[model samples]
Target: MAITSANQLELLQTAEAVAREKMIDPDLVVQAMEESLARAAKSRYGAEMDIRVSIDRKTGRATFTRVRTVVEDDMVENHLAELTVAQARDYLENPEVGAEIIDEVPPVEMGRIAAQSAKQVILQKVREAERDRQYEEFKDRAGTIINGVVKREEYGNVIVDVGRGEGILRRNEKIGRESYRPNDRIRCYIKDVRREVRGPQIFLSRTDPQFMAELFKMEVPEIYDGIIDIKAVARDPGSRAKIAVISYDGSIDPVGACVGMRGSRVQAVVNELQGEKIDIIPWNDDAPTFLVNALQPAEVSKVVLDEEAERIEVVVPDEQLSLAIGRRGQNVRLASQLTGLDIDILTEAEESERRQKEFAARTSLFMEALDLDEFFAQLLVSEGFTNLEEVAYVEVDELLVIDGVDEDTAGELQARARDYLEAANKKALEEARELGVEDSLVAFDGLTPQMVLALAKDGVKTLEDFATCADWELAGGWTTENGERKKDDGVLEPFDVSLEEAQNLVMTARIMLGWVDPTELEAEAEEEAAEESSEDATEETEA
Candidate 1:
């Protein structure tokens, strides 16, 4: 039995009802049917065959039209075919020999095969419409926090039903050490929303720093109301977190607001994070003090910052070193990331020892070469030359720029400086040799051959030069006419030594060369003094 027109109308109504339930547009379905029919006709019929199909959106009416060309000769059905003059006259009252004719064909009864084809077209259109609707719905929801029910687990990832669509929470994006079960209610931050061929894909993350920030916003009313603003957040999710907050209103304590009364607010966030610790620090413009606070639970005694290197050395107490470093150095590491600094932690004892060693090293170098007092050490510090090596290698003009040092004084200092450096290097070499060290001149790059020759000619070649030369004599006559020390002037200006400097130099050289024993020299002086006293007593007795 053939179906009536009413039956076709009933079928169209049924398809529209299904589309509405599936969130697919009815017009889009009808358009898909028409397009499918045109494709099917082209595939089955020749390309030259002109065919048009249309479907009524409101009514269940479909129509097809076939267009044919009018020509002089009959060659093909649609391309070069033509109707005789009598037939053309019957169709048109007056028709030209070369004119075309378009004839309307009655709608073909959609048989079983054709009906099946139309149904496939309708289903495909409905799916495309649904995908478009989903893409448009979720594209604007990125970065929003949403509550979802666990749908299923796939490849160690949890698929969540977020009302509109399913969002995948990857394993890495899940909070550390936290697990999810099927149908579990969880809140996650929407990390991304992407349009795929099938539909919109939403990505959820519980490990994102913004997740904690949004949680704080929800738990702390002051934040959501805009009285307090969270400036920054850093997390080692499932462990510890640091958040910097500022207040828009001067009267409000941003930290206190986030902490709530008796720690109720922050505790709520902590509970959500499975009891992970949170450090709510107030935002400060002072970098050093701010960093000190950022590395909390381990009090910082001092912070030496290198802005150019984006590095900071933090000094804490000996007892707090482990705390500052945390388990596997996590504390300091996170603090470094939070403050955007490369942090090096040192205990107070370590820092003090370092400073003392540095000071002693500098003092040893300056005292040996420059004939300088403690005042010179203070000057070197002010000039940013904290070590004796710097003083030994730097030019006299550079030293003169230091306050309390003049060109003449710098010249005298420089002249004595080379002698001091040579003595220091000789002492270091001797000590290294005694210790069976292979690299005796490891740090003696500043001791040039000319400097060694100058000190040698002055008799100040060993570590004992200071003991041999009087401070006044060494300081008084060390400069030339131009107030420049005669330092290693190859053949033009050979290094010269004054009588007093030469005497001191000789004593130093004798000690270094092992020609005179230091202990024997002291004993000989005591013996000579006793003999002179005994002789004076004998002369008195004879008289």
Candidate 2:
């Protein structure tokens, strides 16, 4: 409809209706209508003129005006919108340089094309306002479950009609066996709410581990109240899942609370998950204890934890080995995920056999490398001497403390070890030089002669080459050799330097070459200090 004084009330009513339908403030809609009228007035008043429109909130009367800002003659840029103070004085008395002079203009009759243009502008504004409203409503709602109806399926992805806006549930985020039809009510975790050019796109997920955790929080009051905490959750989607819980209160039992009265609480979660098995285990601070709890139903006889490697060797009865491994290693895999440890399952008989093999191998290694007799080699093995390097590095007093080894024999053993290492290093040094290793790299503290040879063979011969190497590259990682990358089957030759040692060696080389400025380190330290201060302030506010 054309905008005129007679229909101005109708325009206000239309804005109110649009705002009500879009769930936006009416003031925003009225402002949008005013802008649309201003754009249409520009077509009649010449586009170069600055036209504006305002509508009375109570009377719904529209006013059209042309605005000009007074400026000095030298400061005026656009002649249509800016007038010099001398020229503005003719219209108003004593006009200041910053004064705004507005002249009332007769309202123009809206043509058909002008009405179309105005409609387009109003719709665009309404759509933008709706997007902003949706973004504000859903942005902070991420990680919470929202119930929606399945609106339609687009290429196997379900578009859900959430109350305020639509959300997309990708096929991969849905459970393996679950399917939905149009109008089917579903609940999903808000994985992300991202603002796009078209609108805000909400992504939903039902298979996320946090989704299960949120479900438990909804069903269990203790979890919602903070008395019990869900420490970790691992899910197999439609098959099985496990969650670890701990109680802050000494008297409260977290597992029993999560289980509810006669498994009613857990059963609710299970039903929501489409009958997926749920194991709500109690969390433990100790690593071994946690692993034992994570690998439930299959008793673990013993657990050998290698903390540095983040691995656990679990020994179970022979009959329980298959059970501990589960169908296709699912049980142990889930346990590993739950406890954040790499689990190696072993039966009692297998552990014993492996122990015997390792003992014999160590004995053989000592006897061959140290040139010791069988009895002496066996004695060294019993004393926990595995390799020639250990014997070479140990203190003479430690060797003396061993049975049948007096001071003289200890001294002799030490001398032999030193001589063997020196001879081997000398041989490696010659080999490194033959491979064209630079003197600077060979002089670096952490790069042994063997490491030097390895670097030279890989074309990393100079100090600059070593400086450019990352710690993972200098330490241990997969390397492509002979047209193939190294596999994890224990046949690759890993670098000998540790990550810390490699970093030190690289920094030392860079410092020697003056490649790094000391001021950069100072700036980095200051940045870290500032970050820590900010984090402390945030934590204090939260507390």
Candidate 3:
């Protein structure tokens, strides 16, 4: 239909209605309407002409204009849209070659087909505006909690009506086998917000560990006020959860604050989570201590942390083994998640057996390799000499201090130990050479003869090959795949190479090959230090 005076206000009215219904700005809808009208006008006024439309915000009056550009006589291509400068002088006192010549045009009488097309354009723009609005609103709301009504369930996925938009709580994100009917009120963590081609996706989760932390934040005033901080959280969905918290205020107990008086604060969160048991532990800077706290109700005899491997060994009394490991290892698994470590739990008896096995193994090695008697091997093992290298290189005085070991005996022991190591090195080198080990890698300073053989066996036979290896490949590491920690066996892991040592060795090799620049590395180190310093200062100020 035409933009008549009688229906001029109808355009603004429709824009307001759509904007209000979609919870978007009216200006966006009005602009969409103007463009749609201009497009419809173009179809009627000849597609070659540039048609423009303006709608008054206050009066809702529609104004249409026809535009043509003045060009050089030879450059004029379309008579409908462009005119030569000489021909434009008839319509204007002065017309520049690039200037637009605009004139008011009568509104187009839109046909049924044109009206439908214009309607589609307005709808498309409104849909885009709504999507933008939803994305903008929920993007920052990630890592937070939201309450909504369950609208429906499709293929086991819950669609939640969150006021202005719908949130999807996938089946995998639900706590256990939790089910809901239509119109059921629910609370979930906004795990992610993505703007995809179809629309903005608001992924809600009830099983996320952060969901529990946020619940405590909501119920615990100390946490909301920043007197207490939630350091970490681990959850088994509806079964159990653990939260590590720390108090900045000396007067406040972080655990007690989260637990509340008579367990009132924690009770609320537990009820909301379908009775999920929560253990609120005080966070500690010391990892082992923190792990001990994480595995509560289980008495830990000892905690040994391997920082480079990000793993920990926990020894408990025989009676507490079941408790420490929990039902199906739940307790230790949650503790590992909270501490970000791979935990290996053992009973006191088990640990003792392991130590005895190791001691016996060392004694056997000395007896066989050094040609020492059983008693002498036991004595050497008792003195903490676990390897031939240690025995060969230890101070002579250390060996002399051992009972019944004189200067001659110490010298003899060193000679035998060194002879065995020398023979072993020669054998390893021969094996490496047979496997096509390169001279460049063998002459490399850091790798031992055994290490070279191992590298050759693993197909890393050259300096370039060694330089291309990642530090983790040489030091061994843990990887999380499909949410389970898997051990990655490194070529040099058997030699007890730490990640730091592996990094240094690889970088040294790279520098020797001129693949890396020392000056650039120094500059990068300085930049990293400055960034770390700035971050620390910012954190201090925030605290």
Q: Candidate 2 local accuracy as lDDT?
A: 0.87
- What is the C-alpha lDDT profile of model 1 across 1-543, one tens digit per residue? 123476557646866887788776777776776766654554445455666677666676666667655655454344423565556787788877767677665555555676677678877887888888777887887877999999888888999998867899999988786777899999999999888876778999988989999999999888999888887788888888889898989999998999999999999999888888999988887778889888888889999996634678999999999999999888887787678777889999999999878777776556545556777765676567865556657877788888778877776766676667677667755654554332322223333344444444555444544335553343333234573333222210233333445455546546665768989989998999999999999999998
For model 3, residues 219-254, the per-residue Cα lDDT tens digits are: 998899988999999999899889999999999888
Candidate 2, residues 1-543, lDDT tens digits: the string is 445667878877988999999999888889998999999999988898999999999878889999999998899898999999899989998999889999999888889999899888998989999999999999999999999999999888999999999999999998986789999999999999999988999999999999999999999999999999999999989889989999999999999999999999999999999998988899999999999999998999999997645678999999999999988888888898899877889999999999889889988876776788989888888888766777888987788878899988887777787788788789988987888787988888766676777788778888998888776666644455894445222101354445577677778888888998868978998999999999999999999
Score each candidate by Cα lDDT: 0.72, 0.87, 0.94
Question: Judged by lDDT, which candidate is best?
Answer: 3
lDDT preference between candidates 1 and 2, better one: 2
* Candidate 1 displacement at residue 7 in angstroms: 4.5
The prediction achieving the highest TM-score against the true structure is 3
Best-first order by lDDT: 3, 2, 1
Total backbone collisions for each predicted model: 8, 0, 0
Shift in Å, residue 231, candidate 2: 1.6
